[model samples]
Every structure is written in structure tokens, then in C-alpha cells.
Target: MDEIRKNPDIVYTDKSGNRNYGYLSLGCDELSVLGGRSPLQVYSDFMRSFRDEFSNLLGETIMEIQVGMGPAGELRYPSYPESNGTWKFPGIGEFQCYDKYMLLSLKAAADQAGTVGT
Candidate 1:
């Protein structure tokens, strides 16, 4: 354990020939140095690192949407309500149907522009 803690890159072999890899923790200074500027800056750096590490493999970009309550406690909802009248619950929560449509429109535009995959 001591050896593994000292050198995390090292691989150990037991008497039974089973191999074990070491574990390491990241320090704040190391994170700042490697990530550069801030953690968000690391996103662009990932492309270069991934390309260099996996030159022979193909890579693609992906975009995702995250839905959550806003600072004012407002929640997002689907563009259109269910026609079956099942979603007509009262006082359940605030729903912003337009936001979903906006996101869908943006996604459609991105797809048409070839920025998003099929």
C-alpha cells in the first residue's frame, strides 16, 4: 500500500500472478496546472489530449442539455401539454413550455447546420 501510494503509475504483481494498479489523488495545485485557468477551460483541452492519446480512433463531439430550476425557482417543461389531459394537475409546479420549444428549435438548427450528429 505504501509503495502504491508513493508511485500510483506502478503496477504490482502478486504471488498468484494477479496484477494490481495503484491509485492517486489529485491536488488543487495539480488540477489548476493541468486544467489551465479553470476547470471549464479543460473542456477544450480534452479534444487535443484525446486526439493525441487516441490518434488511430475516430472521435466526435456531443452536446447535451441540462434542465433544472432557475435562480428564481422556475422550472422548465415541454413545449406542448399532453393531449390526453393527464398533465392537468394543479399546483404541482411551475411549467415553462416555451423553453423546451426554444431548445428543440436550437437543436434542430444545429442539426441542420451539421454541428450535431443525427
Candidate 2:
């Protein structure tokens, strides 16, 4: 809706005709802004970020190899409310900032996604 697009925050929309909350777009540029890199490299940069951030949080340096050796799983959000519309599931705020910056390359990937959890 105009409210979301006009607002400073990004908005998600499944259909241009309907602006529901279930649509979750990945914004990478927001994450790049945090990491000091361009958004174009988000897909490849995510691993670096995951490793660096994990170490920062854990207070230990764990190489990508170590982390890669572990089982890799996918992380996704459920449907939820958007700027002014309500959605099926809420979002994770913890990773919002990261995903936002890293996903700017794709227009579908907006600056906003879910409610909060990151």
C-alpha cells in the first residue's frame, strides 16, 4: 500500500492487487549497510556474515569450514502482518537487519519483512 511504500521502512506484497502480510521479501542492502559492503554480494557474503556474527556472539573464532561441516538448515519466516495489514505468522527481528542489507539486490526483497525476533 501507499503507507508501506511511502514509509521509511520496506513493505512486502504477494500480489500487486492485494497487499497482504504473508509475503516476505529478503532485503540484502540493509545488511550490506551494516557490514560495509555492497548488496550485490549478499548471497555469497551471508556465510561470511554468519561466521563473523556467530563468533562475535560466541566470543570465539569459528572458521567457515567448521560451521559448514555442521548440518546446514534453511531458515524462513512465516506469514505475518505488514505495514498496515495483518499476516498469518510473525517475523524474526534478530536477522531482519542482516537480511535486509544482504538482500537489496532483488527488488522483491524489501527493507521490511516480519514483526520481530532478530
Q: Using Cα atoms with residue i matched to residue i, what is each candidate's TM-score against the true structure? A: 0.20, 0.24
The lDDT per prediction is 0.37, 0.38
Per-residue lDDT of model 1, residues 5-87, tens digit only:
44332222222323233211112212332313432345457657866776655444324424344223444333222332423
Q: lDDT tens digits, residues 7-110, model 2?
A: 32332333322333322234523443323543346545777787666766554454334322111332444233344444334453222322232233443433
Whole-model lDDT, model 2: 0.38
TM-score of 1: 0.20
* Segments of candidate 1 deviating more than 4 angstroms: 1-36, 59-118
lDDT of 1 at 73: 42
